[model samples]
Target: MPLTTRRRALSTLGAALAGAVALPAGQALAAERTPPVRPLWRAHAHNDYEHPRPLLDALDHRFGSVEADVFLVDGQLLVAHDAVDLDPARTLESLYLAPLAARVRAHHGSVYRGARTPLQLLIDLKTEGASTYLELDRQLSRYRQLFTTYTHGRVRRGPVTAVVSGDRAARTPLAAQTVRRAFYDGRLTDLGSTEASFAALISDNWTSHFTWQGVGSFPDAERLKLRTIVGAAHERGQRVRFWATPDVPGPARDALWGELLAAGVDHLNTDDLAGLEAFLDAHGTD
Candidate 1:
């Protein structure tokens, strides 16, 4: 079968696995086609699950990437920032996978209509990495058509690319997998050491590495360092991102965001979806 046909088949299978929550048959297909919305490809929704509608909110804001923190509870992948916030109802599948699967079907194989670029789903493991990732792997396997997959040294792109982040312990198991529906989120330490097939994203804490917090002018040396890091990662076909940056809405944040854009950062971490969306729009970076 052709790749597109295979994707559609898998999507139908995935919808069946999701039960009633899945989109009604032909509903997505029959829905009117909307003009392709310009997505802020570099906009990363930090703690996206905290938003009122999880994935839907980010999609509404045209964010190309969204992060969801998950914990392993009772053999299930629960979406939460911490253990205390865990709720049985908010599962990875319900909050992310199922919805994404439906959207892909709606768009006839892409998250965004008329666009083949995959939306990035950053899954941050909040519990023990190994166990949590094992559970995550199982969940992702069930919706295989919804995620980008690496199989036997080859990668097949899907509508959404799931990048596994947080919980360093998960690294071992992720590395051990010869085939998986998710990729690892690497840090600067893994820069050139890993391949783009495995570690597709290079993310780290901005505060831990830089002294500048988007105040005044970025230091000359630090600026060079930032660009160098981005350049190195791009050279290896991997993307770079940093969390813990000044997210406050102000000139400082704008300055930092501008600098990041200029430096070719792949994703900008922010809780303010509207803020980033507006910024990216104003700059015509979307």
Candidate 2:
């Protein structure tokens, strides 16, 4: 099936999943505490801002990571994929930050009540990387306790870990931070170029490096390349995620997801929230 057709079908599936899985009661009851659920550590919600419920939807399925693209507009960070789709009310603080803060407090310093792993919040840059990241740093400072931080030579764990992606220029300013609440997201080439403290994640488009689309048997050479990249990233204590892979709902997509897991890929990127949740749950990744 064509990628577009698969996306449409997956979007429909995602909508249904969002509707069926309600928000956790812990979020609604900030004062009342509830035990945290097991997190799907490998699950990463791609373009999570597009979801009807944003962070909540992924949390409902216990996703460990979520991506949000933001444009630095009029001194405000607005969440959207493109300039034409920007909405004034869809500020980063409203859609992600504040809600996360509330949830962390509700869960008592953890995104998923008692889960030790901090949730990964990937902020893909949609504007100039340096200036936008500086502004983002300012915003992140307001919720210092809510995010993981790196200072001097020590790393402090918080409920959420913000990793900056997109425009490569952000790396310059990010590298200069003496104390930063956000980390950099690098490409596969950056695997051994820097330490995990600087670039916490290594992410790139899967199609750019591979010719296969999960059709028949994956080429042995390509499979080796995939495993090599993952192994290198893991050796450095950095996580790996490849976006723009097969997201169409079918055997091909399932096959690709399976390969990713078997190869030790840290994240399974998908727009279909429930689709990934079910796949991981069934496969025992939960």
Candidate 3:
């Protein structure tokens, strides 16, 4: 073939190759720009057992932190908001632990697809603190290989991290355990006082009396209070979350969420997953 013809052919081939290579990179860039697969502040479902679908409801709501109140009955861990409400069929393992374990396995140890961080499992014990924790330890041991374990200051990769809430007596003994899995969830009052090195997160009630609105104009006093709380928790290298925040379907909820986001609160307590997702979409960091 003539030189001119050869040159034209070569150029065409180069263009095709370039297009092939650039296509994937361009597609990848688009995927990267897509909204994050997970929420900014971890969405927590309080008393998840109370929800109609229980564990499924929490998962469907994209709740990164799920609360299960369990009572120990006849060597079984029954899940319920109160002891009288306990059902034999709704054991902690059946309702949550087992499903969570299977899910972590299915999702490669994270609730969110492609998530690197383990989802938080906040188990609120309602039985005798010591016995409940002991039984919990036994049950958790069955899935020891699937929980996030920490030592000193390092986090180990695993399915999830189980943090005990509701029973204060469980904290000291839990801390004394030599086990790698499981940790304590501390309260706001214990924020600056705990010597427990493995307390994963601090959670508390954010009452309606607390004044925080999403009006882009937070009260200076409340802002300072929030900053102090979040800063102190972060200083210990732990995350902070609040429950019982306004769940009302209006400005009240938005305001509190806004302030919580502004204050750098790690998790936002909300049963309204779609609402939270919309808000995060509007003001997400990503």
Candidate 4:
């Protein structure tokens, strides 16, 4: 073979090898350029303690938010939807706090894997508002190292956020307390009207009257209304959530979920975990 021809063939092989070597680096760069996956607004388990597995169910279902209604019984925070249903074995610490603490310790203090956003543990005050909250403050203080504390709208991770719902009277004491870990979930009416009374989220009941559904397009009037609510809450740096939404099969659920997403509602409340997961996945919101 001619020396020039041999030299040309060697150069071609060297160029091919160099291209092969650069491919992975280029691919890695492209992968890095791709935005990190946005964490899903979790499938919130409403009254999760009522479920057979409780914490296990929430974790298995990949819920980002979980709720437990508690009544202070004999100085123990017992989980129950109704005041009469309180069970001693189902203490808030046993059902939620302890497990969550263990998980946070395991995951280096975050709930979801690779998740920077803290999981939310909403406690609906089911007993007398004042004493219950006082006890709650004590119990939460025990796990203070595990809760996300916020003051003047700044958030930092410890374990999970404790949001108080249900008792309207709890708000006053909560606002008065100098302690900083727990936050209030207020009603929609309180959003635009109230002073910065220490609420981190506003949640309301979504009625059948709400018109927007996940169909071809969202309705303008309803969209505008929702946007106003979310905007007002966001202005105060408070997140928005809704409960009592239609849970049965079909478009009604989809419509509400769709509209909520479009309006940038912070949390989607649902008792049906599988349904919420499917809806979020379908809408590309999860």
Question: What lDDT would each prediction earn against the true structure?
Answer: 0.92, 0.91, 0.76, 0.77
List TM-scores for all candidates, in order. Answer: 0.90, 0.88, 0.79, 0.79
Candidate 2 structure quality by residue, lDDT tens digits, 1-286: 9999999999999987763424577765753545457799899999999999989999998999999999999999999999999998999999999999878865667888778799999999999999999999999999899999999968998999999998889999999988999999989878889888899899999989998898999999999999999999999899999999999999999999999999999999999999999999899885
Off by over 4 Å in 2: 1-35
Candidate 1 versus truth, CA RMSD in Å, comes to 5.6
Residue-by-residue lDDT tens digits, candidate 4, 1-286 = 9999999999999986753323377775784465444445646888788778997787766777888898888998888877678778889888888888766654555665457777888999887888888888888888888887765645665658888887777888788766577888888778876543367778887764355445456667777888998899988878888888667768867877777787888888777877887777778765
Q: Model 2, residue 102: what's the lDDT?
A: 74
Select the stronger candidate by TM-score from 2 and 4. 2
Q: Kindly give the stretch of ten consecutive residues in candidate 3 with the minimal lDDT sum.
A: 16-25
Estimate candidate 4's alpha-carbon lDDT, on a 0 to 1 scale. Answer: 0.77
Clashes of each: 0, 0, 2, 3
Q: Residues 152-256, candidate 1, lDDT per residue (tens digit)?
A: 999999999999998999999999999999999999999889999999999999999999988888999999999999999999999999999999999999999
lDDT of 3: 0.76
- Determine the C-alpha RMSD for candidate 4 after optimal superposition of all C-alphas: 15.4
Model 4 TM-score is 0.79
Which candidate do you rate higher for lDDT, 1 or 2?
A: 1
